[model samples]
Target: MASPVLLCVGLSHREVPIAVREQVAVSADDLPEKLRRLKAIPGVREAFLVSTCNRLEIFSVADSRTVADDLLREVGPAGAPHAVVRSDDDALTHLFRVAASLDSMVVGEAQILGQIKDAHETAKLHGAAGAYFARLMAKAQSAAKRVRTETQIARGAVSVASVAVQLARKVLGNLAGRTVLLVGAGEMAQLAARELHQSSASELLVANRSSARAEEIAREVAGVAVNLAELPALLERADVVLCSTGAREPVVTHEMMVRALKARRYRPAFLIDLALPRNVEPSVNELENVYVYDMDDLERVAAGNRELREQEVARAEEIVREELAALRKADRERSAVPVLARLREHAHGVAKSEVERTLAQLAALDEKQKKAVQAMASAIVNKLLHGPTSRLREEQGGPLAEAAAELFGLAEGPGADPVANPVANPPEGEAADVLPISGRK
Candidate 1:
């Protein structure tokens, strides 16, 4: 049977606008159903979906390369126009890069790896991922770990949250005594809260629809949890407001910010909107002394950070390439296994049959003499088979194995098994290990 092809199809921040991305974005509650639909496609053997704020991709192991077309269709018309497809090695490479955060808008950001792992676990839970995806996920995680450990790509303000904090500092001059309000308890909000805390912000207030989640995040940053109902009061007190809620409408309206600004006596208020569909209204930026930065603004700052880490980014890419090469080499060696097994089995059968016939003809010989003859025959068979066996292994069971099968008249097909019809009184000692083609030391 032909090997399954690796395929990746999706749209990312590089190709799709945030508005279109928002339209195609899959919520946590909807991911399982989406994955189920993808897995049901004809020729799709295994599949998983990765949906983040910046990208939505489907990774699959399928029987046909054209499965990309089906995957694009699954993405729907809005995303299909902006989608890109990668197959085989290119697909594998893209997955590794994503896990390593090399393909992120903020390259070398630390969140993509965890996001990918979560997506993979969700796929496996819903029966969408199989053996192929399990193995691929493991390799991608290993590559990400290596990049983090061996390179400096993750150093400094690499994440969008951290970059947003940096921008806040540049605008307000200092975060040291600033009261920062986090308007959500999501991963991005928690990250931004941590960044602000590390910058020595005097107080951190977490406001969320879920008080328990807000309290959880607040405790981690040595802050307080406030009720979302009191957002206007929290906004008035906060010098910097970071919002990353999942709400469809703008959570912080222009009117709310205007009132907060009047309450603060027109002091500069820095707002970072890290959510898709945007938590803060765009009109809020029109207000004087109020600076609002959204995902695109954060990305521009992140681009400068990427420029600063060009060397480390290059190193991370090298690690990804190394992992990809190693996986391909292992796969090649595994492909050669069946051919080598057949070659050894064929040779052992011929050696054993001839030895048995010769021994039967010399019936006058004693048991010890017969045993000695058997050992000699076995040793000769081992010596004769050694060169061919080594050559097959060296060639990773490629063309040499096929040629050897042809020469020895061995059966060749998906179901071919030379050992099914065993040779009676098989060769002993050194030749014993040689009988099983995979047993070579």
Candidate 2:
């Protein structure tokens, strides 16, 4: 029988919009049921689903190539139009790239590795994954680790929220005892608040027009919720200001910052304006100790970091290729195992049968003599088979194993007659000529 194919079928950011991706996306709570359903599909021997913000992929070991069609059908209506399919080596290579984060929306982001691990574990827990996925995941993780450690691909911040944090650190030295003022409770502001929270900021003040929204974000980041009316007071105390409000005009005006800067005795303050309409005034940057960064500035930093990461991608890809070659070689050697076992069993059986026949004819001999003859036959068989077995293993045993079975008249599996043909159990007078040690055909 042909070995099962490794198949990957999915819709990623490259092929579809977020709307289409969301339609097929599986949540963590729903993964078990999704995996169970996939395992039930015909020809799908083993499988796992990787669902994230950017992609929804199904990896499977399948009996037939048509399993790709089945997987697409299962991913809902969006799958057939946008899904890309890869089989065998290409599929495995794609998996390795995904685990290494090379295929992420923001390349070199580390989240995809953990996401893949979680998906694999979920599949295994639900019995949707078997030996094939276990090995594939292990190799993929190893390759990802190598790519991370051996290259500089994951060295910098690629997201706007993270870049804001980096810029804050660059200007403020360290956030250890610094207070951060979050000027909005919108999604962008919330993300910035979370990033600053993780940086060990001493205090985070959340200010928003809606008191309830401000309090909600404040509670999430372990901070105090201040009224938007207290912006001037909050600015004076804050070392960093992150503004992402929905106001039409500048919330942090030049005059407001000037008064706040004087009250604070001109201490350096880093301001990040993430709002689309510019929450902070452009002229506020003219203040000697005040640094203002708008969305354009953050995007520039992110773009620069992305370029640096792109430069490291070639090296990361080299590591992945090395790992892939090693895995393929290991798989080939593993495939030789059963064939080698069957070949040795057939040889040992032939040797034992011949020894038993000779011993019965020499019944006059002592027990010790009969035992020694049997030992001699076993020793000869081992010595004669050793060279062929060694060569078969070196050559990965595929074609050579089939040839060995045919040459020795040996069956493919156990419980078959060892001497099933004339070549192996030659008729009486022909026995001497069969497999002669001397070159006398």
Candidate 3:
């Protein structure tokens, strides 16, 4: 038997550029298949994967460092500088941090927490999550809720949509009484609409391929709705345009912008492209007075907000540390379970073996008397093992457990039967940087 080891490996916005992040991100539709494949890998006991615009992370339990290496190879390009690995305690801590949104590009964004939940649930649905991940994910979710409840980590505009609105304000000044255009009516577009509305964007205009969806969002914001075919015209009238559509190709091409810019006499328009495949053509960014910003640009804005939330971030970190310690303590207690179970089995086996031997000599006794003798033998074994069992549970990672194993002749050495010494040894050569699970019993 091999002791389970937790491992994580992948890249995030913290280390990789958006282009690279985009290249490796697995779509939500593709996640279940990826998770099943991960569980199929040799040495992996369980697996869960989180893939978002800002990060791509794989969380798993396996038998050795090879599992981490294997997972990295599965998800990341060879020698990818953006990808990194952590194991055991460090991996556990990382999971908590990610769940709590402390490791997010926006530090305290609420979306990452939901994204983590989605990933965990997907893994569970596919039968990839096991006992280890069940507890870990529960704790991570609890930690995230606690951070939001106890601190201001999630306060203010902590989303990409809000950040984009803030950037628009930075370029075009207060959105008060300004005309704002929303291009998709999707979640991000809706969020941007609300943010701009709160900023007193005087007029809201919605344009989408589906006139009904566009009208729905436009009505909600008390704005005018139009067909996406009218975007070239709307672009001329609006001051800021936020786009998040499902189009496979650019919705706003360079020629379209050139025409829109010429129509507005190049009156300086701010454009935000939130779609993954990008709603606006990249080349449109080169047009004069046609400012185009995408997910990466909003990240820069979020970074500034992160600086203001440094105190909240610090407070959040303290909470994670406290929770992590409690988690590890419980983990340490669990490590003793197998050791205690084996000890109990070995003791009972001896008692049974001896009881049978004594029964042959007790043929002179009545059946009732022989039953009493057998009960007494079992009781004595229980009493004899009770003290050691308590110590084994109480003093995990201490010498007493190993000492008791030796005393009972259960410890494995040269010529010892592997079947008899079923307790697994701690993994070796686990890099200090990788961080092994501590306090193995």
Query: Of the candidates shown, which would achieve the greatest lDDT relative to the real structure?
Result: 1
Selected candidate, larger TM-score, 2 vs 3: 3
Model 2 Cα lDDT, one tens digit per residue, 55-132: 888998887667777887877885556777776667788899999988776567777898899999989989998766
Best by TM-score: 3
For each of the candidates, give the backbone clash count: 0, 0, 0
lDDT of 3 by residue, 352-426 (tens): 889889998778888898889889988998999899888787776335655666777665433232221111232
Better of 1 and 3 by lDDT: 1
Candidate 3 residue-wise lDDT at 38: 95
Q: Residue 138 of candidate 1: its Cα lDDT?
A: 91
Give the TM-scores of the predictions, in the order they appear. Answer: 0.82, 0.64, 0.83
lDDT minimum window of 10 residues, candidate 2: 417-426
| Clash count, predicted structure 3 | 0
Query: Candidate 3: lDDT over CA atoms?
Result: 0.77
